[model samples]
Structures are given as structure tokens and as C-alpha cells.
Target: MTATKADRTPYLPQEPDLAAPLRLFCFHHAGGSASVFSGWQRALGDAVSVVPVQLPGRERRFDEPRIRHLPELVNALDAQLDPWLRQPFVTYGHSLGGLVSYALTRQRAAAGRSIPERLMVGAFPAPHRRHALVDADRLDDEEFARRLVDLGGISPTLRAYPDWLRAAASLARDDLALGLNHGIEAFEPLPCPVDVFTGDRDPLMRENDIDEWAQHTRASFSIQRVPGGHFFPWDSPALFLELLGSAIAHTGTRRASVA
Candidate 1:
């Protein structure tokens, strides 16, 4: 039997209206939590309900063991998301979350299941072209933290809190391991539309790699660039929200035509 929403509550700490016509599932970057997308509901307003996916070993699920492998992580998420696929929804992921979103979509397609109306991938290259910018998983604690700081994933304020830094480093290592170790053996084009978001100054995602995402989807594909680094959504929420809102509108229109 499939699990109910309550049973899957741990995976999705922020619950939205199950009956909401349009659901926007947001996934966070490495070393991040659902809290990263907190308050997005208010930002996007009622037309779309924002539901943030909370991975294990972070935030409220801190006691749970972290998932270090891509396949394992995607399987766990697929199970939890199965029941929630009843309505029109979109997947919005940043960095590592983008990779997870794409993998999960492929998993669903492999099972002949419903896919997202739109796949919004932010700051992540297409799977086939994913090359590690930094091998955080192999780095020592201090070096890992330094890499995070350099990437804008760690802030100066976070550096003062040793305990928080250690915890973030641990989560980052596991997430980075999943990303670095996962290899793209084959390329399968998706049926759903894809929107790729990048930052003008993001050094990790090369322009050529971002453009290559077009080859992964037979459906409509587009790219938008904002004025920041890898963490542009955090630095420029207004611009990010504008782009997201436009994508949601486009998806909504598609849903109407299908109905």
C-alpha cells in the first residue's frame, strides 16, 4: 500500500494544500534544508502552493542517517512523492537538488508514472555534463568548510558558530559525495518542459553545459540568467521569484489546455 501524507511528513516538513491546483515542489542546494525555501508561499501567493522537500539528516530530520548515494536518495524521495503526484505540480531544485529533481523525474518516467508539468533546474549542469567543480567529499573538515565559504554556500556569520559549521560540513560532504560519485551512463530525453536557471557569475556551471540541457528534453526548454553567483536565488530572491512566477504561469496554461 502507498503511504499517506502524514506518513511522509518527515520528508516534506512544509505541507501545502493537497487539493491545490498548482503545487511547486522546491528542493534545496547542498548543506541546505527546507528552511531555505521558507516564506516562498507568501512570495508566490495562493495561485501556487510551495512545498519544500526536506532531505534526511538535516533540520527536523537531523537524527535520521544521511543518504550518501544518489540512487538511494532518489528512491527514498520517489516513494514519498508517489502519492503526491495526483495533481498538477512542478519541480524546482537548486544545485544538488536540481540533480535530484532530474533523477526523480527520470525514475518516475521509467515506471510509467506522471512527471512534473515543468522541471525548473537552477545552478546545475545537465546530468550528462556534470563535472565536479570541487570535491568537497574528499576534503578535510576545514578545507571543506573553506570550499563552501568560497562557493557562497557558507556565510561569514555561519563561520562564527563552530557547531553549526561542523554540522553543515557533514551534510555538505554527504551531498557532495552523492553528486560527485554519480555518473551519467545514458541520456534519456524527458517529456516535460524544462527551464534552466543560472547566475551570471556562477563559475561552477559553464555556459556550454547549461545550454546542453536543451538536449535532455523533447518538450520546451529555456534558460534564464540572473545577476549573482551559484546561490543567486538567495542573493536575488526578487528576480528569482519573477522567473519562477512566469514559469508557473506557463505551466498553468498548459494544464488548462490539456484539461
Candidate 2:
């Protein structure tokens, strides 16, 4: 089927803020929707235009088939968001979304496009490392659903509806599959600042492995171990935003000095 503009785009509802000095493109976790970053603009203040990106198959894009390959999705994203990317922006991605953000950065860099001022990767391990969810294809349906539930990803209310739980689980399975099979053998270190955020009790990323991200960037690198589990961005939105704001501020300061 020929894809519509809506089908081709991954970005979701975000009020236009042309005057905002900075643009923040937020990528959600696997099985998560753009709604995850709803109202972030107000919380972050007028300085930023909070643009929440929705991967296909969730929320507003539910009818659009999900891209199960990382490179494919990254290419599409780079094409769709090319215009906005030329402006000053930052990115924050959680879990599977972190891989997307990172890959997208590389995609833009390869094409000589403008990249983000700062990249905030949260609740995910370094892209080069083989993490626990790498073998998602091996897990059976029941086992996978249980794992998603155990991770506190799906809502408790979804349990009341077994069909909803199953749907959520299936989406998560596909999302994980893409990340596991991202097929990135070469690591071209990024040019911009890369800040890593981990949940204190994250099941996906180990504290010791957090340092691995330092090798992915030539510019500034920092790590923040914040409260909550893998879903800390949702669990502690305020704390995450505070840290994010500070990281972006530091990036802006550095850019000013270089200019």
C-alpha cells in the first residue's frame, strides 16, 4: 500500500513554538506512545518546543504499520524531520527509543545534516553492548508478555483487559526486535554532547556499563543516575526534566563559547 503523509511521519501532536530558542524531540520507549511526553512543553517552560515523536503503530499512528527495522526507521525519520533538524535542537530517548535517537543522529551526520546540540539517552545501555533484551525473538508469547508486565511497562488497568495486554505485549515484542536487530557494526562517535541517564534500579542497564557511552562521543559526556526503575522518565518526570534542562543549558553555553 502506498503510504500517506501521516503514515510516513513519526512525529505527533506538539504545538508549534517557532519563537522557542530550543527544540526538544522526545522519543518514547518500546510499546510507548507520544502521549508519554504530553504537556512537557509547559513543564519545560517557553524556552523549549517539546516535540514528542511517535513511532508507527502507536497512539495517533496506530493504523500505520510499525517499522521493525532500525535502519529503515532511522532513514524515514531523517527524511521526515529534516527541516526541523536544521534548527537548534536536543533529543531525549528512553530504552528502545535511545537507540533510535542515537541511530538518527548518525544518519543525519552521514548526510551532512544538522545534528542535535545534545543527545539525552535514558534507561538504555550503550548501543555497542549486547544487553539482556537482545534475544527477544527467543522468548515465547507468554514469556514475553510476562517480561513486559514485570518491567512495569504496561499499565495495570490493561491487565483487566487481557486483549489489551496482549496487544501491548505484541507491540513491545516488535519494538524490541528492531533494537535487537539494529545491525550497527560500526561505531562512528558522535560530534555533539551526549548525556546518559539511568534509573537507579533499571533492570535493562547496569550501573557499571553506564560508562560505556563515554566512548560514543567526541564532545562533552555526562551521566545521571536518577531515582526510579526503567520507567523513571514517567516515574519521575520532574526530576528527569530538571536534569534534561540542565544538560541542554550546558550545551547552549558551550555553543555560545565556540561562536
Best by TM-score: 1
lDDT of 2 by residue, 184-253 (tens): 6678788888899998988888865689899888888999988988888777889988888888777662
Q: Backbone collision count in every prediction?
A: 0, 0
TM-score of 1: 0.93
lDDT value, residue 15 of candidate 2: 39
List residue ranges in candidate 1 displaced over 4 A. 1-7, 253-259
> lDDT tens string, model 1, 113-229?
778999999999888875565365567898888878888987768789989888888788888777875767586788889999999999898878799999888889999999899
Instruction: List candidate 2 stretches off by more than 4 Å.
Output: 1-10, 253-259
TM per model? 0.93, 0.91
